[model samples]
Target: MKKLLLLLVAVIGLSSCNKDSQEPRPVVPEGEGQPISVSFTGEVEDDSPRALEGTVNGSPAGKLLSFRGKGDVYGWVYVVDKDGEFAKGYKKLKVSEDGRSLSYEGTVPTTRSGGGTIDNATAKVSIYIGLDASGVFTNKGFKSIENVGHASGSSLGDDFAILKSENNALTYVSRSISGKYHEYKASNGKLSFSMAGSLILIRFRNEFQSPSHKVLWRKISGVLIKVADGAPLTRDPAIIDQMRVMNLHIDKIKIAVKDGNTQLTGTNEPSSGFIDNSTRYPNGYFFNLAKTVSIPTNTNRGVNSPFDNRESVIAFYTPISKRVDGRAGELAAFSFRLQNEAHYKEERFEDGLFSMASHRSVTFRSELEEGRVHRALLNITYQHVEGGGKN
Candidate 1:
């Protein structure tokens, strides 16, 4: 009986020792080194157009969120260690069918770039959205990404153009992960992104008065806008009319991403002269209207208002400089082609003086802001003389 009790006690002690010596199953604390979940929670500007409400390829209209073609939206996630070296390579984020979420296919690194385990408290995760495959490879090696606009010879790509249909206009966004590891890990590693740029809405209006019954406002053939300085130019001595009008468009915009922050540079391309280099406007960059806008003739009403027709143009991701002077600076100059119908009682008025195409320009001191609509009223008024008015 004594030997049996001793043997039983020894067996129990051995079993208890084994259970205590186990590695505790190495608890992973949930979401440790797991793939991240990315979702588009929408943009900061509420009133502005939503970025995801556009179609790509044959995808459903206003349902696809991509630029140029399908699967063009590439993502670069930087998992940096304490030494600022990349811990992982580029990961392609697959976009969900709903176009609302994106996810990485690979698992997050458990170790640092060098060798040791990643310091979740000190390490950082930076994410970049809206880059193409080419763009990603071109900028992958660098610690940061820099995009030079038209002025710097680097193209902003086809996706930057706002007028390229509702579905085609796209911009880039970036964000750096904040807070502690457990906080993000517990939430399943979801992130929200906002637009890194602004929108400029240019509302054009014809507020002109007719001097005589014979001359009537017909339509505006085209509109041109340029950045300028000094005081606004006069109607009679139109600066744009004196100089040859060159077809200029904003081809690119500047953007930079560093240390997890994104910014749009205010550098713009210089305007070229039509005749010679001497006529070149250094600070002037012109954008021509894609189409002509016609104004209806209201014979009874003397003034033509934009509220009647509501014709406007939208400039996407255009950068505006901060006002140096407390007052308004001559930020933009507008010129438009004015057409009119003139009739005299005697003849068909084929040779009428006012029948020729009229070109008028107006410069105003106004400030342009981002994510807001700026209304520019081009007042087309005619002052008739007793003999013959100037064209």
Candidate 2:
């Protein structure tokens, strides 16, 4: 009869909808933790400026090198709720021996009791460069971040505060630079994630060999990479697709300097070559003058370059994107200090924005001069099939 036909059609439609939705796979045995294995093996999009491989001032301008990407790559899995937000708990993945893969084995918590079936539930996976055991995530790749505890599956919004440690413990926490964002799925026990974003490495130094202080410790207070106009910088993989779809452009970035409170904006001036010069940046950006290192006489590396002292390199990681400048490239920002200025502890900084066409070494003076990949990235470089070949 007509009534029977209508009921059958409704049942079929409901089944079809369930099939299309991101529902959890059939549950495994109660105690058998769902095995979630994540592997990272893919080429990140390269938009750094090109460099000619030749001699520069009688020295090799370009040297072949690899990329030993800073920090340990991490994988985080989050459970999603029906409202399209992070729910329940998340698992911190373990890195493989080769550093290309991350894995986690545990029951996907779907109930308050901590042990329940994931059937009909949703899962999201996110992969990122660097590791932070601290519950919160920051932008200073391989550097210390705000000491805070954010439980798994917590909703992170656009404006998150990074707190400074009150103690004098110089504990260093890794900042996650480029992240693969979030990938959602109704799982079947196994999951895989790939990373294809760009990396931003920011290094620091004292341009002068001598300053007026005993320990002219120049430090980068913080680093921020904004991808969209209204996206939350979160580790939850479930909402990555939403943020990515919102916008993949670099809206703004802020890198707080040590104490000068300087803001450097990029300019087309020919004199803007690298050294902290004022004339090059007519945009009214503050440049730390006093072009000499201000450290203890005996502790000074004495050499003008930071590379001479292995401790001078302060690396960072940031997501890659089609730059807002229309060239569709990656952007980077830097924070610096000259006298152990505690800008980070005070949180007194104004974010700045800038772009780099060429993705070269940030602070390795010899490597920058020779155009070689810094030793930090020696094991992770790849030759992008663009203009010529670039890392």
Candidate 3:
């Protein structure tokens, strides 16, 4: 009886200690993009759009949490700190409209982080990019970039654009604008108007170490693209209105020299027209020539078109000054192939222009010196952006 009484007293003491302890809650691990569990308050699988709710793993001991969305509704659901560049990838979640459940072939945010081509049923999703007390969305700075916002979609589209920003060229496009644009700011980066609706923030990525694109091209000549000489010249003062001429302004071009140095150059004059050498624009004026064919400046030397297309381009551009070749006279006349990828398109204005995110990525190869003027001879290949193969 004495031993039983002692055991009961010990049990009561243990119960009292247990009653004083606080309950522990499950949490997301730090650094890793582990899932943060939260209750989905409503019918998430219904046909109508629905917001998926969840708590970001607890941060800072007593920190408040915040959230937002990145990428399209169909892309990975990103987990990040409230303010910073977006994370590498996101969580792969199953979204459904009719309950068929559409998802990537493989769980992304693991296998791939960007350039996702969606061609299935429309995926409507809304993710809350939550922030913690420290004013960050994730403990890591992945989602902590400035100007945090949400990204959503009403359809599963093949083309997507990434937002771009820079010093002067309007780097900030509203993510709320339902489009994406890739900001090519490299020295030899190419810019395409196909991304018209989307923004292309161009800068001398080397600008941090080098001069601005403006300062770099200050001394260099712009492009001189030539289409069919037979194109009827227009008397209009606007160079763009002459789209009937089957030509466009050589905006920017990216080229890699046979010696293996990549150079990015652009137009002192934004667009060119039927005006040839006769029309005085600047030291870098593009004139429509009779037979001579050359690609525009800075384009991927290997991926432009032949000079024979009804719409061919020619430009006289000099790369930014380099230690090897300072701002000096033209280099030795050598030939390189220009496979034209971009096309001569005539678009109508006044209406909201078509929104497109142009990949327009290209490759190049060195060609032999042809004659008096040796240059790259690019075999214009049709812009085949879908098949994952060249045309």
Candidate 4:
């Protein structure tokens, strides 16, 4: 019996030793494709391609992939997988002077007896970038990314290389830590991305301008209301809600042209107000409308000042999808009309009617646009000139 117990102990120790011998190697359970998140950042030296030099960090096979994001006129991304993920350091990549690209190389892992099979796949990428008339990087709402092909090798983590096209620019591709990224494109189409922890999709957009790039229409008005005592300007529920919906802030609004060029595109700081948006679409356009109607005063309502019952709703139709930024020269021909009507009780004032209309054919330049609701906000402008009231 003692001998039997001793034999069992020996066998158990050998089994434990064998189990502990296996290294920490990651394997994605058999699945067609697994989720991955990639992010990069860099600076641009010139204006041609959108790629720049930056650092890359992401979960590669559920482990952090460390590498450098190389830049050509266009940009390409390459990650170096050392023998172990926790191991430090990697290789650097660069491109030729002509704007053609470069790549990164790696080695794979193997098992005993050379029996296990794993794909040794390498990435080949091509890139294109567009901006808008505003000198802003407009990507409609997102950029387009395509992979030429991924060549597979014999074993897991085998030596592989990522190649770039001879003529293609290296466009930068990246995502946030949370894995949210925008892809601006010129054509209307749907896209799917393997986000960090989720599967995301881009729906096709159809519009002259993307809603993200579209402006909210509103009118800034200065009216004298019949408030007996102290009244909070925000007490007006409708007025408060308007502030939340539109980018309406009461400040001096100045309109100027880009270098006095009628056919100008983006607004130079001296000429236009800049609109802020995400990287999906970064360009904007400014066109002149032949119609600029002014309402002197509210003659229809029983009021003392120029502002009584006067309002304006700026309207605009935005593109259905996000266009590439820096491609702002693209425009949508739109017919816009500004309509205003003021009604006054006959007993309230001498004249009981006031109305104004403005219609014009304006082309809206939008490359960095998404088919969401663009802003077309109009500010209420109450002509504060004296005698403007219908006395």
Best by lDDT: 1
Tens digits of per-residue lDDT, candidate 1, 1-391, equal 0100000000000001121222222322223343332232221122222221222123332111122222323344444434443233334445444443444533343333234444344444544543333222111100100111111111123323221100111111222364222212212234444333222222233333222233222223432222222232222211111221122222223333344333333333432221222245433333333333344322222112222222222222322223223243433344444322231111112122232233244333443343232333333334322324332
| 1-391 per-residue lDDT for model 4 (tens digits) | 0000000000000001122222232332222222222222222122211110111112111110111121322222221111111111122223333222233322111111222211122211111111111112211111111110111101111001111111111222333345432211111121111101100011111111111111112222643333232222211111111111011111111111222111112232321222332243223333232233232331122111111122222222211123223343654322222222221101111222211222222333433232111222122221222222342
Q: Which lDDT value does model 2 have at 45?
A: 17
Please write out the lDDT profile of model 2 over residues 196-283, one tens digit for every residue: 2222222222222222121111124543433323222221101000000111212123222222121112123222112322354222
TM-score of candidate 1 to 2 decimals: 0.42
Which candidate has the highest TM-score of all? 1
What C-alpha lDDT does candidate 2 achieve relative to the native structure?
0.23
**Which residue pairs show backbone clashes in model 1?**
none
lDDT of each residue in 1-391, candidate 3, tens digit only = 0100000000000001121121222222233332122111111112111111111122111101111111112222221221212222232223234222223222112111343322112211122211121212111100111111112101111111111111111122122222332111112122111111111101000001111111111112443222222223221111111111101123322221122111223333433332332233222223333233322322332211222212232212121211112234422121122222112211111222211112221111221111011122222222212222211
TM-scores, each model vs. reference: 0.42, 0.27, 0.16, 0.18
Error of 1 at 85 (Å): 7.5
Flag regions of model 4 displaced more than 4 Å: 1-123, 126-331, 337-339, 342-355, 364-391
Provide the overall lDDT of each model, using Cα atoms, as 2-decimal numbers. Answer: 0.28, 0.23, 0.19, 0.19
Candidates ranked by lDDT: 1, 2, 4, 3
Total backbone collisions for each predicted model: 0, 28, 63, 71
The alpha-carbon root-mean-square deviation between model 3 and the true structure, to one decimal in Å, is 29.8
